[model samples]
Target: MGRAPNTPYAASRYSAGGDGPVQQTAFIGQAATRRRLLGGALMAGGALAVPGLVRGQVLGTPSLVPMRLSPDQLVDMKCCLRPLRAAGPNLGTESVGGKLVVHNYGHGGSGWSLSWGSAEVAVGKALASLPRSVAVVGCGIIGLTSAVVAQRYGLDVTIYARDQIARTRSFRASGSYTPGSRIALVEPAGPQFPDLWEQMARHSWRMFRTMLGLPGEPVRFGDSYAVSDAPIERRTWPADPAITESFATAGLPRQNSEFAHLDSRIADIVPQAVPLPPGENPFGMPYATRSSQMHFNFPAYAAILLDEFFGRGGKFVNRVFHRPGELADLPEDVVIHATGYAARDFWGDRTVIPVRGQTGWLVPQPGVNYSLRYRNVSALSKGDGIVIMNNNPDLGDMLGVGDSMELPNRAPIEEAMATLAAIFARSAGAAA
Candidate 1:
């Protein structure tokens, strides 16, 4: 018989008849050789199916950006209340002590994300009065953006606030483009609100694009990974009795109250999330997904907005308004009331609910540029610092609903650091 070609898949040929130890030894050797070839072929096929595994080993896990996760790394902690209104942001004009007050506050957690768009609405209304000048009530992101928008229309703008941008609650936010984050209760906001939300989201998205390549990367995109041990499924609102009762007791939105999710409306403009294959998931978790998110670097972003406002002949007045009537005392007949959560008490608007949010800042790690979420905790490595926050998917927006505590809590951040530490440790062990 002729010998077969020396290929992994080729069949081996043996003599038609064989006897004694010499023939048996030859047969055994051929069987062993065939087994080796078959095993090699299976391994080669596996390598082709999962190139990421081979590349991961060679490239040292490109997806797993190293982070120094520890409580000791926490340099600062900030707590702020997101002003959530049941009927969405107050964008309508109202007569306040004879002054045409255009309400632009109560954006909840979507203030930064919807600032420019909301500003367009507020400023447009303010301009209709044919006022030569305008006054913004707050110095937060919404107020700052609105003032800048007013300036673009050639309206001399003056910001009257007790606190500047740095001291305002907006400065403490986990600055990200979360356009629909607890913006409003679906039923209370009505059908028209979503359209308004889309308008604002699209406008703000376009405005953010303009600031992308600016100095200090005030607005930039980064990859975010959501890692989990369980298989990723469609997230649903929690129906747990305890959670519902707590929300009810706190006078917050119930579990059944759906929050407006308007992100899908602008999906074309925003980046979509994609599931990560097993071989590509570097988080050491069973399931993972990645998406790009826009982040606002507070110091740089605030500075640029402030610079543009002042460069356009705008002014800031260090004044505190104890009542809505005080707005009429301002020189400008048209005013934009962008007091954010403060509008709840100052404007006597009970619809504005306070949702407490806290973030811990860590020393900046230039090498780590990605963001991650694992075990109810989220971490984003920004140019200024690494921001870590407690964001449980199960709780949804209800995580901080009805909590007005502005004092920073160190315990939650410490717990989040520990969770991150375990994640990184397991990843390191897997790599080793």
Candidate 2:
């Protein structure tokens, strides 16, 4: 009982009585091994009855696999991990000089999507500061862009973050087309936030438009298409409570609406924003509208933005600021909090939930000019001509979102590949 279990072997063999079935089993195994060596098919004991696809050095693997987005499009969560909660107190309160503390963080998955618009809102308040020095917390898109706007105003600005510029989540983003109204306006009041919405969007658009042809930087102009599966009667944002509470911008034509609802606002701004002909929409999209999402090549864009900031005599300090009282140490008069989701802990403001949105990208579709989407599903072939996304709307916030939202549901990437594979599959005449 204390020894190894032996089935095909006899006790007599071990007792030195005679040769036994154990030898026969070993002999059979040897024979099978020899046969496998010669036949190029190997058997593992009695477990397997047939060879598997991976068992041999096969030829010609299919270019794509189902539910797998552009294999070329990969995201590493390690580069984009934000602590689920702040370990200490919110560090962005108190007056930097004589100005008020304007908090602007908690943008979860929509950082890239709403960067320009959100930054405009934050910067609008910052500009009102009239402080000679402005301090921006966190080093992601919002902070960087806010700092840029501050610089444009000729204010001496400083950036503080636990990490550096390119190493932040903004760099790892799958930045695609902008669905602007993604931000949740937390106002207990009624339809009074539209004016600020209009102001923010228009400014961000103008700001982004101004950067259209720079020599490869953060702000870019690239054609983006929104192909839909159905007619978009996008729900309108009745009103933004925050806009009302913050800016008193009520009833000025700003609403939380879908893309089709506000196509006119961005028509002239986006290069290819136009209605798609009925024949081009396969997902049964009742109407199609195209726009060039403010293309942000994180690598080049974020680098250039930060580079320009630093080059322009901006000061950046590398320190983990966990409490607002800690800001007193820095010699600045104003602080613009661009801490992103970390504001949850820093400010103790739970109003900001990590609205887990995701985007999937393809390798690059050079000549592909149109952005297409059916339902929330979308596609782009530039620098990877596909982008798919899944947000917390269905699944709720991503606690450990890190960067790769493509993990459990494989949301964005799967949709991207299936879409491309489907289109090409049709072009190649493959069955759905």
Candidate 3:
């Protein structure tokens, strides 16, 4: 076969040099030399240091993670969140007020982190009751993930959704590694929920780690989330026992974010986090902080995972249920509720607000590896791709610290041009 069309994604010649003339290719006159030192960008399994790059590649495999590796799996997307279209008429089996109800919804962001842990808790109730048939509502990240977990527990799960699995908010998301406001104190809190939140975070983080071991999918790289000024205190908790116990083991300091604007329940988990020196910050926000994160390509990862679920004896039903009575017809004993933003209407959960985020990605700028986000708006370069992280809107959230609901009408090409132009303008301005 002739070589495939390069399209516009062909690597830019100027990406290698800071602000130099463009070369005809990704490699340069000195590229042969640099190639020996910097062959590629970093992935989960293999990595090497080319002296200048901290998280990029080296000449050979340096202590590979012993898992399959495929850098080609990385794919850039240009899409928008197809928000739920309608007033869902409660196709719930259990009662909201009193009908064997177990409601798990309203994860504005951080749905991935809270997915497995939340499903674990939701399924625990159904398992205790010994239901033979279970019904799962919504096929967003929460629903699909919950169904997978329920199936793992040997429950026959029927996933019901109005839209196709890959067309929801889950797909539209620029899946960053940070956990946005999935859990909060909007509900009256006791010590109980705080413990559960901590437990859920740990479990979700571990699940993500396991996923990183897989090959040819979106899950890799250590990121440093630069959080600016924000309030980290005054959140409520839940009422769960096992969750509480597992949380105490976290060894996190209480009043940690209280005395300061920073908290550290996960500082021990991520290996790379330290205060940046005065000149280390990229955008120069008021305060610069760094915490390792995982920027993801949601479509690739979800496609692989969903295929695995369906292939492994899992069942999914595509129907937009209007009443809770419709769920009773499924062939299972236990049910898990994993609907995310859809819960806004399905369960009358108004908390599932849609916070829109706009990101501009140019053709791969491989050398800019470090993810730099001080506000919700950020600029970072992937090996051969790029994305701007989104946020779940909340009070006290810093500038560019929250995703918008503006529909992200910007196209990738437009975004890429704008970003590159901005960089070019800044450089030109500095020279003058």
The better candidate by lDDT, 2 or 3, is 2
TM-score of 1: 0.84
Question: How does candidate 1 score on lDDT?
Answer: 0.81
Q: What's model 2's lDDT at 101?
A: 77
lDDT tens digits, residue span 344-363, model 3: 56656543334344454444
Q: lDDT of candidate 2?
A: 0.49
Where in model 1 is the C-alpha error above 4 Å? 1-64, 238-251
Q: What is the TM-score of each candidate against the true structure?
A: 0.84, 0.61, 0.62
Q: What is the C-alpha lDDT of each candidate?
A: 0.81, 0.49, 0.48
lDDT for each residue of candidate 1 in 257-293, tens digit (9 for 90 to 100): 4677777898898888789886567666778888898
> What's the number of clashes in each of the models?
0, 33, 28
Off by over 4 Å in 3: 1-101, 180-182, 225-263, 277-291, 351-354, 358-369, 374-376, 380-385, 389-406, 409-432
Best by TM-score: 1
